[model samples]
Target: MISYCVFDAYGTLFDVHSAASKFQRILGNKQESVSALWRQKQLEYTWLRSLMGRYVSFDQVTADALQYSLQVHGFQEDSSKVNLLEAYKKLDCYEDVQSCLNQLRANNVATAILSNGTLPSLKTLVENANVAHLFDQLISVSEVEVYKPHPSAYDLVTRKAQIPKEKVAFISSNCWDAIGAANFGFQVFWLNRNENVPDVLPGKFTTIYNLNQLLDKVVQPS
Candidate 1:
């Protein structure tokens, strides 16, 4: 049985694009592109920094990514960046998150968040969303000074929870993160909310459309 259900925070439990969506009036038709580039660059920076052994908090990486995205789209307003960054601290949790988390708790499965987000950001996000009570822990990659897709980051879960990798059900909306957890020997589930094609990665994971499907896969029949 899977004793713990470990989740990826951004884009999985919370909507990463919601920050940009909040400023849609200012962004106009560029909203979607800006959000996409910001998310893409954010992930790229984490991977690059991990490999280069230059670790920085996820907050800084997020700011840098947002700046790059805004500059690329010819958006020079300092207030736009400030407002968006502030908006990020309170990102909207996905519609399915609450129901899924409640069900997991009812089923006696322990829950946690293992993400690239820092501890303060994660705490603010869950508290803002009012789902802070549902999680047993909110883990940050900062504990290991690295980000996802790195073996050490995944190890944090096993170490902190005192659960073996095989007994954990790791879920991520990001294909790379799912792959990384799977490679680390967890029973991985890919929450493919956008119906996008899978990444051409070496690790193996089961794909599900939403969090509801996760209960069926991981919860043992009683």
Candidate 2:
């Protein structure tokens, strides 16, 4: 049985694109492009840093990625960069997050956030969204000094919950993250919110379009 229902914080629980959307007045028509590039670069930087053994906090990576996105889009104003970074500290949670987490709790399942985000930011995010109490833990990759898709990062859940990987249900909107967790032996669920094609990776996992669908898969029929 799955004892813990662990989620990836950014795209899984919190809306990563919401930060740029908040600055639509300034970003104009490029808001979506900026948001997309920012997310893509953020993940790339983490993977690149991990492979190079040059670990930096997610905050730095976030800022660096945003800076690149802004520059490429001709948004050179310092205030634009500053405002977006601050906004990131309190990203809007997904609509399904609260109900899904509540249902998991009602089922007597433990919930946590396993994120590439730093602990402080993760805490700020959940607290801002008014869902902080719903989670039992807010785990950061900083603890292991590595980012997700890495074995050591996925191992954080098992270590913190004191349960074997087989007893943990790992959920993520990112295909790569679900693959990583599945490869590490957890029951992985890919929250494919966008209906995107799965990545051509080695690890195996079940795909679900939304958080509510997760209930059917993990919650055994009583």
Counted clashes in each candidate structure: 0, 0
What is the per-residue lDDT of model 2 for residues 1-222, given as tens digits with 9 covering 90 to 100?
977999999999999999999999999999999999999999999999999999999999999999999999998859999999999998999999999999999999999999999999998999899999999998999999988889999898888889888989999999999999988999999999999999999998999999999998887888
**Model 1 root-mean-square deviation:** 0.7
Predicted structure with the largest lDDT when compared to the true one: 1
> Model 1, 15-41: lDDT tens per residue?
999999999998999999999999999
Runs off by more than 4 Å, candidate 2: none
Per-residue lDDT, model 2, residue 108, is 91
TM for candidate 2 is: 0.98
Question: What C-alpha lDDT, on a 0 to 100 scale, does residue 203 get in candidate 1?
Answer: 92
